[model samples]
Target: MSMKNRHVLGEAVRHLILIILALYTLAPLLFLFVNAFKSNNEIIASPVALPEHWTLQYIKTAMEAINFGKALGLTFIITFFSILLLVIVSSFAAWAMVRSKTILSNIVFLCFTAAMLVPFQSLMYPLLSVFEKMGLKNVQGLILMYGGFGLSMSVFLYHGFIKSVPASLEEAAVLDGANLFQMFFKVVFPLLKGTTVTVIVLNGMWIWNDYLLPFLVIGNKTGSKTLTLELYFAKLTSGQYGNPWELIFPAVFVTIIPIIILYIFLQKYIVAGVSEGAVKM
Candidate 1:
């Protein structure tokens, strides 16, 4: 074979492998989706094929059971505030740790890194008591808790990323007699845009999807559950295996759609951030 023809064949082989892997990964989702449309008997009979008689009855029943609107609102609120606080608090704390360079700064940085490894599961009771004592049981409390918990990871990422930023930009702002706050907002922080976008996207997704912490902290109170919490209920039931999968698929799709939209819109930023982390390291 000619060299060019040989290269084309190699590319084709790689493409075929990727296609197979994609289908393999997607198979379960496809299976669930098809079975969702099938009746219980039909689903058992044809687990992998399209339903012969597609119906909206299962979807309607699921929506009624799930209480779609209420569930969605609850999820949105939890995700929004949690992400907001996680981003703001983590960013500020990270900026201070990396930029200040004091003895306390080193200690703060270490504390966060240490906190990340501290196994949050072990601290569940203590954390709950602390929040309860502080009267943080509501959404505000939940946001603050997410902020604190997410801080270590966010700061760790931000600290490393900010360290790679050139300090000369801040020095130039200072030369013009800009105050520290002004200098940070206008000059230093803005320069960290790439890193900031990266942190936001990363933390946003994490906070949006986390279930355990919120479950413990927020409880199963109405109007406070997150999408993750909603899905948890859908995943299993007490002594029940007959629940239709289609009932939960719509809610699952709702949970994921935001992340999909975000990635589509900011894919370049996300990719650049991931690349920069390795290069900086």
Candidate 2:
């Protein structure tokens, strides 16, 4: 074949591969969305086909059953506060470690880096016991736990990105009469906007969709449950005999909508922040 024809054929093959991967990734989500409008019988009978009669009945029922509004509000509060705490604490720690460049700082940074490899399951029971004894096994406690668990990765990212940032800017701010907080917040933190958004997007999705932490901390109680917890109990109360596909599909569909919308809007930042952070490191 001619070189031009070979190039064209290569492009065609790449496009075909991309299309297949896209469809593969999207297929399950598409199935869930379609089944949200379907009855259990309809879903079981024809899982792949479009619903014979699309209806909002299942969606409404799922919402009412799960106390969707309250759960959504609670989830938003937890995720927002958790991300805020992670960004503030992690950024401060990362910045200090990077600037200090001391033996102790290096050790601490290594500790944080090592922490990312430790599985939560290994510490889960002990953490719960400690928090329970401290009377922190509630919404407030959940937020704190999220901050602690999310800290290592956040610090790692911020550390890399902060290395890329010139220390002269902070020194200039200090020389101009800005205090510690002002120098860090105004001069340093603002420059970290990209990484901050990336941190929020990454941790927000995890916190929003997480079931285990909330289940262990909050116990699936009606009054103080996150969306994921609500969905769990919703399934349990739905029926004893078998899976409740109708309720399950719609509940999961609604629960994920917020995070999906968030990812859609902030999707661009994930790659940019990760690349910029890793650039210096």
Candidate 3:
């Protein structure tokens, strides 16, 4: 075959593969959306078919039953504060460990790195015990828990990115009478935009979607429930006979909208952050 023909054939193959992958990813979501408008009987009867009668009542009922607005609010609060705490604490710790050369600092950095390998299941009971003793079961408490769990990986990412930053700017800031707080926050933190965005997006998605941790910490709690936990309870409340597919589908869709919106807006930054983190020191 001619070289030109071979190249064209290869490109076609690649495009075909990409299209297949895209469809594979989108198929379930498409199914979910279609089923959201369907009644439970219709969904069971024709799982993949178009809805016999499109309606918004199921969506409305799901929203009300799940208390989706409240769950969304709680989720936003947890995700926002978790990311806030993770960024602040991880960035500072990364900066300090990178800049300061001491035995204790080295040990601390090593510990953080090591902690990343420790499975959460191993620590679940102990973490619960400690948090209970510390009274950290509410939204504020969950924020702290998320922060602690999120810190290690975040610090690892930040630590690598921080090393790529030149020391001269911070030195200049210090020479110009900037104190430690100003030097780190004003001079250093702003430069970490790429990594910070990466950390926030990564942790925000996890905390928002996470079910098990919140279930354990805030199970059946009247006023405090993350979106995922709310969905879990909704599923249970439906039971086997009274299958509430209509309710489940819309609730799932509503729960995911925020993260989808966030990703759409910050997608460029997320790409930039991952690229920078991957290639830079």
Ten contiguous residues with the weakest lDDT in model 1: 238-247
Q: Which candidate number would show the highest lDDT if scored against the true structure?
A: 2
- When 2 and 3 are scored with lDDT, the better candidate is 2
- Model 2 poorest 10 in a row by lDDT: 234-243
TM-score of each: 0.82, 0.97, 0.93
Once superposed on the true structure, which residue ranges of model 3 sit more than 4 Å away at CA? 239-242
lDDT of 2 by residue, 150-236 (tens): 999999999999998898998899889999999999999999988998999999999999999999999956599989999889888
Model 1: lDDT to the true structure: 0.72
Error of 2 at 13 (Å): 0.9
lDDT head-to-head 1 vs 3, winner: 3
> Tens digit of lDDT per residue, candidate 3, span 1-281?
99999999999999999999999998988998899888888988998999988889888888877888898888898888889999999999989998887899889988988999999999999889988998886777778889999999888888888888899999999899999999999989999998898898889889988988898888889978888988888888876324678779888988888998887787778877876665664
Model 1 segments more than 4 A misplaced = 1-6, 53-57, 102-104, 231-243
Candidate 2 stretches greater than 4 Å from native:
240-243
Q: Please, what is the whole-model Cα lDDT of each candidate in the order they appear?
A: 0.72, 0.93, 0.87
